[model samples]
Target: MTSTPPHQSVLDKPFVLDLFAGPGGLDVAGHRLGIPSLGIEWDKQACLTRYAAGLETLHADVSAVRRDSFESLPPEINVLAGGPPCQTYSVAGRGAGRQALEDVKGYIKRLMAGESDAEIDKKLMRLSDPRTALVLEPLRYAIQATRSPNRGHRPYDVIVLEQVPAVEALWERYAEVLQDTGLPDGTKYNVVVDVLKTETYGVPQTRSRAVLIARREGLGDAPSLPDPTHRAYEAKEWNRRNGGIAAAPVTQQTLYDVDAPEPRRRPTEDARLEHWTSMGDALAEPVGIKHRGRKAPFLVRSNYGSSGIPGRRGVRTDRQPATTVTGRISRFVVFEHLGHDVVCEGPRFSMNEAGMLQSFPPDYPWSGTAQAQQVGNAVPPLFGAHLLSAALGLPAPAAEAMREPWVPAAEEQRAKLRSHGCGAADGCTARCPRPV
Candidate 1:
């Protein structure tokens, strides 16, 4: 049995039930807002990390957890947030999404029409791949609770979901289904879909996610989208369509480059936004000022291996934003561009750097095993913080943590952490600017 979290008062506290919760990203945001949260995750490694972080957990898979389980919860659980495993729908993966999604949608429609499991099982073939349909589990909870005779007890006040852009339409379809199938009183939910660019928020990575929000308050309780606090890209005019409340653009720059002059580059189609926090920013330590970017290499290329394997673009820690972090999270093998014989400087960018780029705290208690898989799959906590705030109709606050843990007293304590390379020590020097 899961231990119930201590509640000071149940009258007005916001409770979050996170399904498919990966290392408690949304849960961290909830805690910061004074909300109590519980996560249901299947991976033992990820659950270990969550437990280490002092979060409540039901170490079980959402697909296996029966619908009756939701009714077992105390009334305080008013908000439900989830980001189902996204590998099958990710662009990087061998996306069998076209066939998988159509089949899954057909299964959902049949289930809604009161078809028996045996009947649907016989019709659906890709049951072998579990990731395709885990998404429907959330909708099942909503519809079953909405149809319950207990009118005094509301199913939920709000529901928020985030996933890869490939799964956007499925979630939008879910919003449509919930609105169409109303409660006994005919009161429907207010739902909206927003595709968010993570850099627009504050994380250093240029990743994009599809977000869906549904509110079950009275009709007038429809929540407004969380306004952007920083300008990530240039906008012609300040309008919601151009990615919400725009501020000065925060473009890509490394922690080493923080003291350097601003970047000068030709504008893109949408006009580039502002300087996003860099992976280097998270690695900066208060050692006496270290040697900064000096001309080490004019051009570089990375991800070199077998001839059949396509090369992954090299990244400059000083300026260019990193590509999305994946489950494997390989180090980009750095090479100098002299046009004939390339010199290998060895790859920088450690697992901790990847996690930091994902906006996990430098000291976050990552379960110390399967480090690459754990960080790659986990949502960035800072990004999750903004989304949860937006769903609640309260404006999302700016990132609240300092760049790196700094003690005003002395530089004696080195940031104790694990990484693929010696992180941010004084001796090593490397540079990567955007290739022209």
Candidate 2:
């Protein structure tokens, strides 16, 4: 394993080391914020996509890297962030992690008591699904970085971890341990944990994630989750009087409205948030027009039934935020309707459109198989920017700045591939011929 130092221009910037990085979502957010980042991903296809996006990457299993006590990790990295795979904890898959939650907490206690990795691995191998043990990998890295004398003695100033909502209990446990263990400088970490609603952060999709943010007490003020920038979405009756096209909800109150409004004025915090973005708002411009021929209104119908009941599929109109975009997003169907009649129907969302709903740029280069799965598994870059900003004690980026499109230059992509010992023909692996 090898690690590359940050470029001279960015050497002074806060560097982020992302583990279990799937196709560089948080890294993209870091790039936009002028922070430097490197991602460690084991999936070959995801690594290919990361290289195409010109993001720095180390393609290796996190456990293998952890074995070396992450010695190859760059000394300049000050921020640690990752979203562990959540299949076992997700409702869509077998609930192995959820069933073994109590046991996992025991493992955390053992780690705190200074148990060897080999001992833990021997027990973890007895689990029905070994992936359940991966959740502790980040905590292990944190403990070693802070307590190991061989390490440069420079602990990460900020630590961020995210997973499925089912893992919120685990995050609570993490917060307790992190705050309990003070650094050698006599400063401890201040931590906060919450399950954030994606729509509240301006994402045009309705999804929830368990997030944990920790900041070293010596590093300025304590950290908290960023304030909501958008109102939460609520299900309202669709108005059939206007062909089922519901009126857009009011986002804020103007001075005139506040003075003469029949409705009571909302509190200051409520008045500050904008309306939750709807699916139509995100896909209306080019995706709807290009794919469906008109931007009027559409309904997305799930192909699979819920909870093993056939013909019990769910549906969402364009007026509402999209239901969670998942790996099986391609199986959904979109229909254009006129009152009581169905005018036309087409394939649901294009990959680009799916990315947009997740708050990725419209032109983000997606080059991997199971692309939808990658997008679904990733943290929305918009949400990540806010989290990163709050964790690092930096001002949140402007809403417009978060929406801006970005693409790497041709030369930049070539240089990134070369740095990873990959070329167009080499396909981004160790056995590939070195660039001349």
The superposed Cα distance between candidate 1 and the true structure at residue 318, in angstroms, equals: 2.7
Model 2: colliding residue pairs: none
Off by over 4 Å in 1: 1-11, 111-128, 147-153, 183-187, 217-220, 233-274, 286-312, 334-348, 402-436
Q: What lDDT score is found at residue 433 in candidate 2?
A: 24
Give a tens-digit lDDT track for model 1, residues 353-405: 56666776555556647877888787777788777776775556456441232
For candidate 1, the 10 contiguous residues with the lowest summed lDDT are 413-422
The most accurate candidate by lDDT is 2
Best by TM-score: 2
TM-score to native of every candidate shown? 0.71, 0.83
The lDDT per prediction is 0.58, 0.72
Shift of residue 163 alpha carbon in model 2, Å: 1.0
